[model samples]
Target chain A: MSANPEPRDPAGETLLSAAELEARLQQIGRERYHSLHPFHKLLHGGRLNRGQVQAWVLNRFYYQSRIPIKDATLLSRCEDLELRREWRKRIEEHDGWPAGAGRERNEGGIERWLVLAEAVGLPRDYVVSTEGLLPATRFAVDAYVHFVREKSLLEAVASSLTELFAPKIHEERIAGLLQHYPFANERTIAYFKRRLKEAPEDVKFGLAYVIREARTRAQQEQVLAAVRFKTDVLWAQLDALHHAYVEPGHVPPGAFVPEGPQEWQASA
Target chain B: MSANPEPRDPAGETLLSAAELEARLQQIGRERYHSLHPFHKLLHGGRLNRGQVQAWVLNRFYYQSRIPIKDATLLSRCEDLELRREWRKRIEEHDGWPAGAGRERNEGGIERWLVLAEAVGLPRDYVVSTEGLLPATRFAVDAYVHFVREKSLLEAVASSLTELFAPKIHEERIAGLLQHYPFANERTIAYFKRRLKEAPEDVKFGLAYVIREARTRAQQEQVLAAVRFKTDVLWAQLDALHHAYVEPGHVPPGAFVPEGPQEWQASA
Candidate 1:
């Protein structure tokens, strides 16, 4: 197989109208994104044994910690105040307000994410510091930042269209976790709850921005490509996790290793 | 492992003196660079049969095509004309001049590399277009370019210190290819012969630049780290190739596959 798919007859025809394009984008998420990834299914299904669950939470914390910074990078690059103001909400959502504003309420998404980490039995410092996340996770996330920095503004905005499909997946994931994991509860899953609400607004703004702005066929194609790249980013992380924690057990040296029965106490 | 190694101990004794650092860096190349990688061993040892060698040349062309562009990026960023002039030689060495007074009669390293591609049965147009290279090769090479752009100048120069070790590897690779592959001869291996002389001068300039500029202990460590990062860049390309082309054969969906019979075709 060629590393890239044979260039389809991209010029053949418009496969979908604007409305259909939007649905096709969502369909891509339904079929290909992390929610459908086997590791994620195993995660939400509670089929992952305890060690696998620990691995998921530990690896995911790396992604969570980088969200605000990635958003802030986007925030830094936007010249228009309207765009900046809209984007600032994402950073604010992750970072919350400074202490003692009385407005400085409970912790933000990052902190809530830590609660999920603790619920899964990972140490707070290790989780917060992201000391043991997979290298593939770091590489994938860095690739996203590079895309945003290097690609056109339309494509950068389009890449964030992953948010468009997020609310639905967020719903499924939360419901699945609650149904399957006794350790998971409404309180522990608060991060997904907030995202379920936040994602729709973000996605609505971003999709409108992309649809209106991606004027040329090439630009429209880039929009689709960006979302595809983002999907791969999410999918690759799960693939690495499955390869490491599930089949064949050929984890790279220095990645997280689950402690066996005797070693479990020492790690604990 | 931690994506980044922990900061080295402040008081850790020096592993190599200034001169010894040069020797150890060369030693690392001797033991670990891609020339020593099993994929190269197969290619140079005549063990790959034919289609595999074509795949090797096709994938490697991506690396060859990027070197001058990477050097040009480094040149563009340097403020000093002397530094730029010194660096410009690398670009010239790889790209050659375009029909000018000092222009060499032959095409550049890129053109020479295509001879290997032709010898191994890949079309020159396909090789030059780089449509067939692995995604991992592009990612790794781009990562190296970004590293040079973002790093301190001393560290950036240090990254090219890999050249210091390249001469030995080039010699070994050349001899190995000539002895083992009946289709490979002086003309087919012209690229390595050019690199044999070019790499040492480039290495000397880079090493002296790094040693003279890396005054503090922290800066020295950064230089060392830069070399290691560059080594990883080269190492990862081979790792990706090995995994995709060799054992387990779980080639990613669209990567290149050998066509027709496995035996070498007689050169025209």
Candidate 2:
């Protein structure tokens, strides 16, 4: 057997020349995001049974719940008003503001996620509390927050470059889930609908921020590593889901488990 | 399938009383710790061929190297000079005083661990650098440092409670390694010999500190959880070892693997 391979040197060049940086960022997402994860394939391809679907929704809700917190962490780190103004929109999108005329026009991504969770038969309170999520998920999510808090702002923004590929994955998920799971309709898929437009705009803004800001080779490498780490965070979540749920009988102790056919509704 | 089972209340009275707390801490070690790990059993039993042993030593040196750092974190957090004095012994034990004619004992636990590494066919430089250890190993070890730094001083002391069980395991390990692995002998087992005497004394001091400090039930629970978390840290190290070296073809990307079999020689 061979020794451990060295991590690729993303800092060989003096500068990534903007276009190269963007391409490199996209390449990382292409090669490593959860969209490429096998569990995601099984999820979007109508292959998993109901129990497996339930497990995915339940586990993913934890991830969904943490997004605003991660974004808020990034918000806390930025010194620029323009950056904060742009980033605060993300938090607002996840937790939308109230509209006038006694109607809330935008109910937020988190609210939409709860509807998706309900479609998969999870209790909204349990989904929101995220007490049932895997330890790996918690670690992975916390690692993202720690990354933002610890790393350079360029790297921190680069970590969000996964958004570069999210729109396509969001579309695939919406179509796949709608076609396969009868319980999942347009209202239940509202999260993806919002993300499809929102992700591209977010990616455009974050990419521009990283490209313009990452001036040194070391900073560029940090950006790449941050993106790679964020990818690992996403990949590990899928790994935990696959190991615990899809592989039946390998569930870790004190992790969520799908109830039997007779007891599913009662457990929910 | 069944729903997720609740964690059983570790069935017994609160380990509030000193004797009961000591017993409960020992029970934690009995249930956890690397001695009970499958990889440890294989190594001590001679079931692992030479290459596996090499990988074990190489990966474990990462852990051996971190003990002082974790202790120093504890020392830094402590406000009382007396407590720091006691904790300083742990640092001194792991990182010996400077060398000279009248110098205090110069070689430390880290040095002795290098001898163990040399016995198992790893180069001292490679062992010291920790260049090729598993990502999971780094995560687990860093998590320990984070625990000590972030948690209450009582919880930090409780994490060190694993030392209370270390003497028994050290004796078992020393006997088993000398009897089973031809490359291992008295010189190589020196680290374990030192630990046999050191661990119990260290644990006595740590337990007293934790018991006196952890007055509230929440604090007590945090202490218990810290031990469990520390146990997970140790357990995760072995898990990485088993996955990389023992279970053929299961090594995750970017981890150590032994080279061609060759006797490691200690050089001046």
Candidate 3:
């Protein structure tokens, strides 16, 4: 939205200063992140019902389950030991180290996500199997994986900067879920509670890497586009969710359906 | 919506009768096709202005132009000469044969689509280049291509059965576009008018192929899921359009933005 002719140089400078680049990256978050999506607002505002929430948790597990693989794809592509060392921690966080192994966190995000799924009264096997994921969920998550695997390393790292915006959503989610849903205790929503801490750590490294690496004007443009693409990946999942589970609800064929006493009554 | 305990084998039959299968396919269309999407309703009912209609055409061109490529992928995977012979016509219809090379139709759907794009006032090259497509558009179309490439042959064929419902929507679209938009004369809307005659040819073959090949309950289930998947591909594109162009529009960072006398003033 800036009046600058060059998209990369908003200030019309030769190269963006690190603070400027970081500001642009944060601007992408403010303008495009899924937390700003209506579904997210509905979610954090506690406007959705249990079945809708359950549908979200179930579909989101597809994305949550794929993070480690996306990280692993990034790790596979990078040549720098220092970057790899910092990045390997993300893989471990999502996929967890072995039980007896000396890692900071032994229980991966996926396991914790399943815990939340069980708390939502979904069968654990169904959530873990991802049998009931929306087609949109699968496509969006797979796009993230392929984007990391295929895009330039700078772009890949930049895409991960959505994590830059994740902690606030996590905080809001924990508060909203606990206040509104009976299932939202520390044990069930621990995944988000942990993400409040973990995302900042991950994005700290990812943000700095993209800012430092994307030096050229064209590279900066790619980095910006990458972040935008990531935001779409996240936002599209919610669009699908809102369409299927929200008002005028036409749940897509073969997706999760709430059982037992009709938990979802479309709010008029 | 059926109360059957088992999703498949509703009658405890080994396989559905062809009539029964056709009915089920139509049912899927009634419930899930993009025709039922709010965007579709908006477009057909004259609720959307020219800019929104242009956005739909432009984004949809991404899907429109890729039909041949998707068909060729299906053709490549198929070993049956009869099936391949039938399928290759789809590619020819979208991409067209070399001018005067003796193909029935020289101007393909893609060219016809550009006519629609021009009628709507988008620059022809911009629509053709697909530079303005939403990330959601690219991802959803790419997912369809991948679905055809990777799924079982029968599933690929089954996904194409969304065309079964196409003639009706095309008829409705032609009527609505002609009635509402001044630019909707036959010359500008040739794409839909052409599809009215062409889609039945495609779906007639596609439907029969699916019913014949999906001989087991399990195969029938896969066929059903494939159609559902196709509907999601379509419904997701409109969701992207509606979210980006409709009320409280948060057009994702780098997607299409309508230019010219700003016709879109978001409804309160």
* RMSD to true structure for each model, in Å: 7.6, 8.1, 6.8
lDDT of 2 by residue, A1-268 (tens): 9863533335544566788877888888777777877789988998887777877788777777778888898888889999999988888899877898796679998888889888877888877777666655655566676777777777888888888878889889989988777677778899999999898898889888887787777777788888877777777566667756765454543457777671223222
Model 1 agreement with the true structure over B1-268: per-residue lDDT tens digits: 4553333335553433578667766666765556656667776676777766777788778888888878888887788787898999888877766776875575778888988898877888888877656655666677777777787777778888888778777878898878777678889999999988788888878888876676566777788778767776776566556655654443443457777888766655
TM-score of chain B of each: 0.88, 0.88, 0.90
Q: How high is the lDDT of residue A56 in model 3? A: 93
Error of 3 at B260 (Å): 5.8
Give the clashing pairs for model 1: A1-B254, A1-B255, A2-B254, A2-B255, A3-B254, A3-B255, A254-B1, A255-B1
Give the best candidate by DockQ: 3
lDDT of 3: 0.83
Question: What would the per-residue lDDT of candidate 1 be over residues A86-203, giving only the tens digit for each residue?
Answer: 8888888887766685665747888898898888777899877666666555556666777788887777788888887788778888988887776678889999999998889898
Please give the lDDT score at residue A253 for candidate 1.
36
TM-score of each model, paired residue for residue:
0.78, 0.80, 0.81
Which pairs of residues collide in candidate 2?
none
Evaluate candidate 3 and give its CAPRI docking class based on DockQ: acceptable
| Candidate 3 lDDT over residue span B210-240, tens digit each | 8788767888989988998899899878877
Evaluating just chain A, the predictions reach TM-scores of: 0.86, 0.89, 0.90
Model 3 native-contact share: 0.41
Output the chain A TM-score of model 2.
0.89
